[model samples]
Target chain A: MALWKNGAFVDDAWREIAEGEDPPPAGHVILPLDWWEQERDAFEGSNAPLGLRVAPGVPIERFARDINRFALIELVFPKFGDGRAFSMARLLRERHGFRGELRATGDVLIDQIQMMARCGFDTFQISDATTERLLRERGAPAYKRFYQPGATPEAPVDSRPWARRPG
Target chain B: MYRYDEFDAAFVADRVSAFRDQVSRRLSGDMTEEQFRPHRLMNGLYLQLHAYMLRVAVPYGTLNARQMHKLAHIARVYDKGFGHFTTRQNIQYNWPALSDVPAILDELASVEMHAIQTSGNCIRNVTADHFAGAAADEIEDPRPYAEILRQWSSIHPEFTFLPRKFKIAVNGADWDRAAIQVHDIGYQIVRNEAGEVGFAVYVGGGLGRTPMIARKLRDFLPKADLLAYTQAIVRVYNLEGRRDNKYKARIKILVHEKGVDPMREAVEAEFAAASREFISLPASEIARIKSYFAPPALQARAACDAYEARRQTDPRFAAFAANNVHPHRVAGHGVVTISLKPIGGVPGDATAAQMDAVADLAARYGHDEIRVSHEQNLVLPHVALDDLPAIYDELAANGLATANAGLISDIIACPGLDYCALATARSIPIAQRISERFGEGERARDIGELKIKISGCINACGHHHVGHIGILGLERKGVETYQITLGGSGDETCSLGTLTGPGFSSEEVVDAIERIVNVYMSVRTDRSEDFLAAYRRVGMQPFKEALYETSKGADI
Candidate 1:
């Protein structure tokens, strides 16, 4: 998966471990929620960086207590229209105070990336070839001015609920 | 009316350019129709039965003469010389090519208007009382708060793709003219013992296949917590609303299944959490918006001799004054409703010529202000009583002097099978027929105030659930059928209309309505008791027996 961070694409270093796959003893690894739940004891003493993949319906409170242990939490949008993950991302960042990297995965379209970022997703896993091509061709369509506060600071800050003046 | 600031202007221009690119991509085959549907809908472009329909937002039903003239220009150029005003106080053009939409949006942006969020599963236009600033009974104008909401909900990041469309209405008068009770969230401006202003928040109300009235979520919420509380409610709904079933995805279903108490508890907890983070509305910004909607300065003048003379000499003028004019808060000024529903005409369809005439009159007599009511009528909110005669003459010349504001001929009907892809039966003809039946002479006037609302299908876009006399059009086995519901109202004393009986054929529906009216006339205590009050007092037994039993005997 091509990981988009800040404004450009970068190599994704983390390996996503599927449910029945064995984990490598090195590098950053992301595990499926169910598998991590069942084998959490094996990683209790390991020094490896960990990440968790959460589906839309999994209540954040279920694993909010263990949020501090993971460096990344990847939220999945089952479909482009399925927006339950947006609310979850906000709750994780603002409510649970999870300051780690929030990644958006599955059905990540160019149109949804701006909103996902506003809702606190810092990285997006782009799989759609069209979206990737559009990103390269047009870059991200940023308005810079917004009516509501977001997780990311709008440039020329403190001009919220209004337009930001250019320096 | 609120004017766009630099922020609003720049944002709209940016959106138009982005949509221009999106449209070009769709045309170039880079985007599939399925992928492009939601994007187009967000900009208020709908693929209707005939062609693309563009719905432009008239924020809180408030616009100036300049904006009205621009709408007229669009209708004359881009559409078939007309536009349809919707129940949510927006205007829709029936025919526009997909390729020309970007240009149309660009034109709209020049007027500080765009169709953003008018459709789709995002927060729709924030509607307010038509007589907000001018109503005699208003506690405070609701348009300022509505403007705040309009800005906040524009391209709302998390809410642009919700389970279902959300609607919010605000009412500030003693009488609920805005129909607040039927929206997803309703705000009623109120004051406490110390005379401090706030809001009474109502949540989860909607009209669709499943119609439900919003329940009171809070008796009073401080003015400062408006956005914070609204964010909380929407967040809770976004997280918990059902996505498994499209029909059951509205916030109303979630509120119903979980109950209002649990919904309130969850929203309050979320509000507490959300308030600490963001959504803190600054008082200076609120005051800034409030200043934009301040009442126009008018010097009191003596009553017009011409107006009085016209009322005495011309019966039509008298009728217009009696039915079409509302009391204004400012002395010597009256609010005039220019009816779009003429006898034997399509409800809410306005010709470009007529729109121009209204715009001209608004600039000449009104405070350069115009308003579109949810009832599908244009309003001159701050018209001086002295200029009534001149305004009436212009209106009469333009075929806009319908003199049927709340009367029977003033109907609310959706563009049914004639235009809408979702409609099963035609609604415009039904409305035209009903208006013709009751159009002539004093029949409608004698019948007193009656609201006849017709919807093409059960989706209730026409608000059939709350009409005093509701008509739902359906198709059963290749035949057009209409079901009638009685006693529904959208006022402060809000109630859902109950089904009268079995459905009627297209030919029989208007007759069915007349028979019901006949029953109402006979049983009513006096003409003062309208159809709804009579139905509530006498119950449905009388109307039902007259409709079905008499039909059975005649057929037999």
Candidate 2:
């Protein structure tokens, strides 16, 4: 049985669909490679970032220009400590400036969610919904940006006290 | 000793509150051991074998009297009434409750002290020459630059979650007392011919299972680009360093595997990109940091002549004066190294009362200048020559006047298996026994300048590999066996020791060390010839023959 499936992230669903499986309502949903080609024109340029989830070690830098035209970049972490995804996220954010939803797709542990968030992850998709409770295990923020808001500073200037200074 | 301005204060206050929240969550089961581990490690809290050990960052081994008193207070109330000074110049408290960590940090914050980044995979408390500001041959005080590195590496983005923990040592003197070569990256501040300050950069030196000396990656890097340049190096390591095995995750292994040329090119490429962005090294900030390390006004005194005559008269004081007193950079002044490694005592363990006595001496006879060496010795810099007699008298009363600085009796030992939960076998008792054997012996002088380092485990907490005679305790089939290694060093040319034949039991280990010392005495070219030089001369033949029963008369 398949352990994980975010319609926005899953390219393969070997099992039967769940009872309350929701379609792509707000964000981009994934389609298999063959299915993607079959439904190519259905993916709108306007509704962009139809995140085509890919496996690890794929150099996304070559497709940087096309990838930015998307609403989200759903990169997969094959396992805990894979680290290749970290470079991918950093390249997208710092180098390519991919703005909208950058979600961690597969095998990413809840323990590493905070680190993922700190590394510019906006959304997390767990593999096993049965063990989804594992997501709130480490440094899970009870309230978003409550006490030390902007503590996860993406840049040094953002962490600086002079961040509010007039140009 | 970077003073906490409002920004630093708020940052620490917020960080403390965040840690406090994390602790509560862990207690309430919102956070598991796995999740709470990194959070706790980031705050310098560790779950050791016993309870909890808090490693506090004594930035570059520089702390004021107020901070020392606060540390003493923590030791008295929260811990076992003593603090162990580590080889990396940090202080470790063996016992503290998990619940009281926040409160302890609150106490630390009152004195401008902290446990921030003391552990975890971050730029650890940047270490430097303990005698930095007042050393006789120092080119410049490296503390200001160390302070800069500390601020930059603390919670640094993109570099925090590194492959493993990183350590950096800086030195400004020609002699590398800071052990710069053994650090992950070493920086030697030097001025170019054009009167511009830069760095002689070295990469990948570390001591563990694999001890390797760093290679010079850059001849000179401009002062303005120091931070950016460091970031570049870390970035290159972060991008390409191995993550398959935890043991091989250090930058040293990475540098060794990939070779220096490629790593240098990658770092330079990153540096070239980072150079466009200024790190804001302003003259005012430099001046501000320099002001914190104010120098003491020295005066001329003729106590040298009086002390010389007394040295010929009193044998005890003369012995102490000869070993303990060091030449100060200023005229008529001398730096005194108070040996904490007394006979049959823990090497670096200092009680609260001893700390108070040192503080008193600092405030009185000295210029309120107290420094802790990497070798776990307390230094009273800028002591007037005339005040040596009074200072010696005061120290003698405090049980700290051990005349064994750089001598055979000055042993460097960690809180081995006896205290450290991670240890598999005992190391302190072995040291205690060795000290007892040579406690009041004339043999100590006959076999001079020996550094016997004993680590209970391979983690090298006692820095076993760097010792001239390294004793590493290991568990062999549930029995404790001590492994002896030879010729390891921590200087500019660092190399891991080669194991010498079979392991010895705890009882036999001390005899093994004594035999080794005895062998050195027998074959040494002269009294001036130290333990390492003699060991290099005869190899490990005498030591092996003396240690093993089968090799009692064996050939090398």
Candidate 3:
């Protein structure tokens, strides 16, 4: 899978382990919520970068205490229309102050990339070539002006406390 | 009306371009219909029974002459010869091709209009009292705040994919013309003891398969915190509201499942958090928005004697003046309601010719301002009394003058099975039949202010739950039947209508309505007592007996 990080498509260095699979002696690995829960201590002290993959049903609050310890956090969209992950990403960034690579995976579409970016998703795992091409060519077809203040640092801030920093 | 600034203009232009791209993708077979459906819906495009319907937002029900003319032009050029104004104060075209939708949206964008956030699960139009700035009873015009909310909610990243659609209404007058009580979020502009204006916030009130009266979430919320508080409410609903069942997906269901106290506490916590980080509205920004809504510089003039003379001399003019004219804050000017609900006509459909004429009238005599009431009537917010005769003549000439503003014939009906794909039975025909029965002007004037609302199904888009006389149409054993409800209201004292006995067939429903009205007419304390007042004083017992006594052969 190609990961679009920063701006360009990059090689996905982290290997995601399935629910029943055994973890490889890892350089960079993503673990499911159950695996992370069971083997928390073993990976916490590891020298390699660690990431956690969370589904929609798994509460993000469960990882609140250990949120900052991970180098990357992957949020699953499950389907194109289900947007629960967007809120989860915002909570991780703004609420928990997790300053790490927030990656979006599974069913990530070009149309939703701008919104995901606003909600603090820095990397996207997209399989569709068209979406990847669009991301590379034009970069998230966002309306330059925004109404609500999100986790994006590019948001405009004005004198109004509610207003985002002026772009 | 809030004028679009550079930011607002660019925002809308971008939205149109994005929608165009999506449409092109769908046309090119790059995206499936399922993938494109929500995108179209988010832009207010719907595939109805016959053709695609596009609902355009009329923010706070306020529009200017140019906008109205553009709407008329769109009707004449694009769709059929007319458009239907809905109970939400938006206009819907019954016919448009999917391929032509992007062009239509581009046309709308040129006129400082768009269909963004009009449909879908996110926040819909933020409706307010139609007579907001002009009303004498208003403490403060609520449209400015409504506009603020509109801007905040439009393309909100977190709320785009909500479990169910959400509606918000604001009212500043003593009377609830906006029907704030039955919306997802209701804001009543009020002044506290300290003499500062704020909002009395109501949460979870909605009408659908399950009707509910919203409970007060906050007795008073400061004006500065409106956006933060609203965001908090929607966030809580987004995270906790039932998504497994679409029927139970509204915030109302969440509020119902969790008691009011718990819901309020959760909202309060979220509000506190949002205040800390996400949002804060400055006093200057609010003042800036408020300045746009400042009332027109209306000259103080005396009531003309010619108006009185014409009213006395012409009975038709007198009836029109008595029913159509409303009390304006300015002494010499009046708020004139141009009835869209002509007898035997579709309640809210207005032809292109009529629209152009109304737009002309607004430009000439009404300060170029017009409003669409939630009851499906148009209002000239500032018509001088001296100019009434000329305006009336022009309206009458164009078949636009109908002297039934709040009278019995002024019915609210949804575009039912005939036009709506979701409707199980027809509501427009029922409204037409009732309007024809009560077609007489003098007879309607005698009946006084009686609201009869009809819905095709329990969705209550027609707002049947809050009408004084509510009719709910349903299909029973392959036959169209209607159940009657009485005493429901959408005012300050909002109440859901109580269902009357058994259902009635289409043929028998009109007779049933007449019988109920007859009972109210006979037993009312005086001619001044409206159907609602009498129904309230005497309760539903008398009306129930009058409806079912003959069929059952016994009175309980």
Candidate 4:
């Protein structure tokens, strides 16, 4: 329930996978998506990693190895009160090596897109907003090769596009 | 005085612009008080007892005439008619508005001055001997190292938010004037047998609620490792110092809790990793910085028959000359400390007019060097001996010739409760009363070499813990009370003062201090055995008895 999905809370009620078998959401561990708050066993089983995200403090202490065990870290902005989330995503991409789809979910105003992109958040999902096109324009200028301190050195400029994005 | 070179000017300008942007953002609601607090404080704006107080770093307590004028202008433009000089040798304007701070910073930047690192948990202003270059007993001047430290610690990324506020002081004098041991890190410059300059580094020394004298970490640190070694100490402090308990968070506590050996070993390990790094001061760089502090030109002169004749007739001049002035290393020159404690005036305070007058005197009579001493007095370091009579005349005319340098009247007191929010009790009033009480005595010389330091709280900004007779202002049951401590010394071997018995009311504190001094005079073998020396020989019992004579209740 902590993870917002499809513009609302993704109901965590478990659904039966097979007859006489356990539920779907039942075994899915819940996490706040903040880097520090994400638990170790959230994705312990043969399943996709639960998101881990949040803002980082000054001088960003958390490194790539710190979050490397996890498969994905999604930066969550609870409210505009937090700034550590932007820095967290930046550190995750450039420093901590979090390369999975970096998503921005909460408190996603149209204003913070460029800086967020510069810091390495690729995809931003606003919870509810009428002007999606305007927001897209704001998010239009995502990247022209990253200049952040901890970015992957070998990107489109160094590696061919086919090799760079395996997906 | 170090001129504003292009580099210095550019850095100050950048800081000013940054502060201006910060102010604009704060005004536009882009930053909250929590976010803006550190930024504002780093730029020297403090939300104090009433308003924002801006403390301008007077590096090594040296200021040129132009800078003094700028300070005076700051007083006129942004504040009341006066600015208060702090115990740390910086000047603070108590009434600058939050809006004008950026503009005030711009004005300061015009003169190669900025309030960067004046506050916050970073290394505060690096102070050195006020008489760094011109003192009689001199090694290499410590100001270059101080300046280097100033540059390195200015907005330093690693050690900005440490366990607590850090202070560093360097001293080259045999007689410690800068209160070196009371700093977080104190370095004394020394030349080894090979005639190469190095430092005797002391760490974990500071004054707070739990006052402690620093301990030596290394016997000798090569001059090259000055910056790296400093960084190492700070890095070790940042990594290991406790942040849970604010009071027990200074480097002194870490050194105390872990013991000096373990803490020192930790620092050395970090230092070994940081050793021979790019931050090391190159020989050429050292000499280049040293060149900025070269001694001013001195012209030869004969011993003054003019001053001799003036002294023959004027007993006042004779007293001022004999007791107040210090001998200079240069021939036919004397270093004069112009007392700001003019009976009722606040210590270390100069009205705008008074500041202009001092600036005028420095330009006309003395060399272009002026020193703001730790005792809250100003020193004209090099005045020709022949000009002594004229200098005394000018000083007397300006009401600065208070013929009391180390006398009981020369009491050192901080801004206390009046101006500083951190103060527990008022210090200025007590200082004024003490100066007034001792003002009537014709026997000023009898109260020889006494140091009465009072701090409002245990922060020891006034350095009360280091005084020969220390008065600490503490609040008792909603009453402003002062506790008396004895035998506190701030020289090369610094020691924290021990409080004797209970506290006294503000009204009775002056009389108690007098009684303590009277007891010293009565028991001393001779006048040469000053209060400190006498107290060293015969401990605090006599002084305690003297304080207990009139009041029967304090369990003497």
Task: Calculate model 2's interface RMSD in Å.
Answer: 5.8
Per-model DockQ: 0.63, 0.14, 0.58, 0.06
Better of 1 and 2 by lDDT: 1
Alpha-carbon shift of residue B204 in model 2 (angstroms): 1.4
* lDDT of candidate 4 over B8-40, digit per residue (tens): 566577667767876886888866786677668
Question: 1 or 4: which has the higher TM-score?
Answer: 1
In order of appearance, the predictions have TM-scores of: 0.97, 0.85, 0.96, 0.80
Candidate 1 DockQ vs. native? 0.63
lDDT of 3 by residue, A90-113 (tens): 888877889988999999988788
Local accuracy of candidate 3 as per-residue lDDT tens digits, B483-552: 9999999999899999998999999999999999999999899988888989999998878888878546
Candidate 2 error regions (>4 Å) = A1-27, A30-48, A52-69, A75-91, A97-101, A104-167, B193-195, B275-280, B300-312, B545-556
lDDT of 1: 0.89
Which pairs clash (backbone N, Cα, C closer than 3 Å) in model 4? Answer: A33-A53, A34-A53, A35-A53, A55-A84, A55-A85, A56-A84, A64-A96, A94-A150, A94-A151
List native contact recovery per candidate, as a fraction of 1. Answer: 0.58, 0.02, 0.55, 0.00
Docking quality tier of model 3: medium
RMSD of 4: 8.4
On TM-score, the leading prediction is: 1
For A18-75, candidate 2 gives per-residue lDDT tens digits of 3344325353455333344355565555553366554555555445656645565677
Q: What is the DockQ of candidate 2?
A: 0.14
Model 4 CA deviation exceeding 4 Å by range: A1-167, B27-31, B300-302, B549-556
Misplaced by over 4 Å in model 3 are: A25-27, A127-139, A155-167, B275-278, B550-556
Task: Tell me which of candidates 2 and 4 scores higher on DockQ.
Answer: 2
> Which candidate gets the maximum DockQ versus the true structure?
1
Name the docking class for model 2: incorrect
